[model samples]
Target: MENLPKKVRSKKLSTRVDLTAMVSVSFLLIIFFMVTIELAKPKAIDFNLPDNEWTYRGTHISCGPDVTRIVTILLDDNNKIITYSGLLFTPIVDPKVLNYGKNGIRQELFDRRKNITEYSTAIGKPKNGPIVIIKPSKKSNFKNLVDILDEMAIANIDTYAIVSDFTPEESKLLALK
Candidate 1:
């Protein structure tokens, strides 16, 4: 019997794959994600802080803020809020207990804003809104403070400050049964 010649086989290619493109693509994706994360970072709120020292008539002098349009809100525990316009001693709108929401504090704020605008216009001044000063006592919760801030935003109040320092008179007023 004649033996048949064995067929020659083609050389087998390497099964291992080159990872250069995959590594480069992965690195590029990582860099893109990092850049996007940096761009998505939150920005800080810009605040215009008043000058600590005031110079008056070529001399440094103490000056008091005009309290006419200033509305002070005292926050107490159990969702109690006492609001008054101007200084406590000589208040434009006497202190009155108010609740949260539209019919309560929101309405008061709207009325005050209207009154203040009219008063300013009558006095030959630009129509200015009220400057609210929120005084949140230690007893007041964070939720109450947030709620008040929401109200301020809802009322479109531009000028307002959260003051923690409570005067003796204000503390006494809050203590009233």
Candidate 2:
């Protein structure tokens, strides 16, 4: 007490938390995501995958004029996938070709795989052919529209896009100018 300073010293409080644990967890999450995400380069049918880094944000990037091999899907007035390669695969009225598989042999996803394996040779590969391009018309039902997507996925049709026309929209904007 005899050696104490003339000015009184105030007590100090500091609540410091170490952030090393949080930084470790963040790094672990980043590594997990990097490992789990598919690293395969974008494989394509007709369109060249854009080199632009800003536009690759969706499951299906839209098709523009640069696209070539496209499987254009048109819906007749009845809204079915009426024409594929100029053939009437889906029909109107009688029998309703689209749902023909509904009442037939019911196969789950597993069953479908087993059958696909058994008939793998019979089912030709699409890799050797013209690149696939999908064109869906307006007014098509969401169900049928998605059905096309499902089939494409099942068929492993990886490289395709839903066709879009830039000319019309661009023309309209040009006219305004």
Candidate 3:
């Protein structure tokens, strides 16, 4: 047998994998998702339904002197907004005709709210704003109600009610208009 010279081959190529670019791409995607994602904010109006007692005891719920702070808004036909302040039993401020817009009912509501807050502070009482009573007549459209509700929210009024009953004075006022 003849002796053969053995040739030494280079070590097998290393299979090292570079994961830096993959990691960077993963981080970028995560950042993009974090930046672009928006959380949903729910918009809603809170309403209180009349209880059984209220039904039995008549619709006019007495709110004391706060009644003076109560603002009654009547949604009339042809997008007319009539507003007054005070209780049904007592003499109320004369209903004023108003329009629908930023300068109209919205401004009045804002001013009334501000006045109530200032008056409360001046009288050394806790700031309790007026309670708005919204009465939508059968003649009023649905959009009028929605717009008034939106105005209530925009005015930052925390207390208000939607009463269906129309008192005699309200009826007379409507008739006169």
Which candidate leads the pack in lDDT? 1
**Which scores better on TM-score, 2 or 3?**
3
- Worst 10-residue lDDT window for candidate 1 reads 48-57
Reference-based TM-score of each model: 0.68, 0.34, 0.62
What are the per-residue Cα lDDT tens digits for candidate 1 across 1-177? Answer: 369888899999999999999999999999999999999999876543332333333465456444566799999999999999988998888999999999989999998888877866765655456778999999999999999999998998777889999999999999992
List ranges where model 2 is wrong by over 4 Å.
1-70, 76-79, 86-127, 165-177
Task: State the weakest 10-residue window (summed lDDT) of model 2.
Answer: 91-100
Candidate 3 on 59-130: residue-level lDDT in tens? 445433455567899999999988887665553466788999899999989988887778667656555677
Cα lDDT for residue 106, candidate 1: 92
C-alpha lDDT of all candidate models, in order: 0.84, 0.40, 0.78
Model 2 — TM-score against the truth? 0.34
Native-vs-model 2 lDDT? 0.40
**Pairs of residues at least 3 apart in sequence or in different chains that clash in candidate 3:** none
lDDT of 2 by residue, 1-177 (tens): 988778977877667888999999999999888876746446545544422111122233444321112233443224343222211232111111132133221122223334433433343422322223444445446665576667656655445566644235322332332
Candidate 3 at 125: error in angstroms? Answer: 2.3
* CA RMSD of all predictions: 5.5, 14.2, 7.2
Arrange candidates by TM-score, descending: 1, 3, 2
Best by TM-score: 1
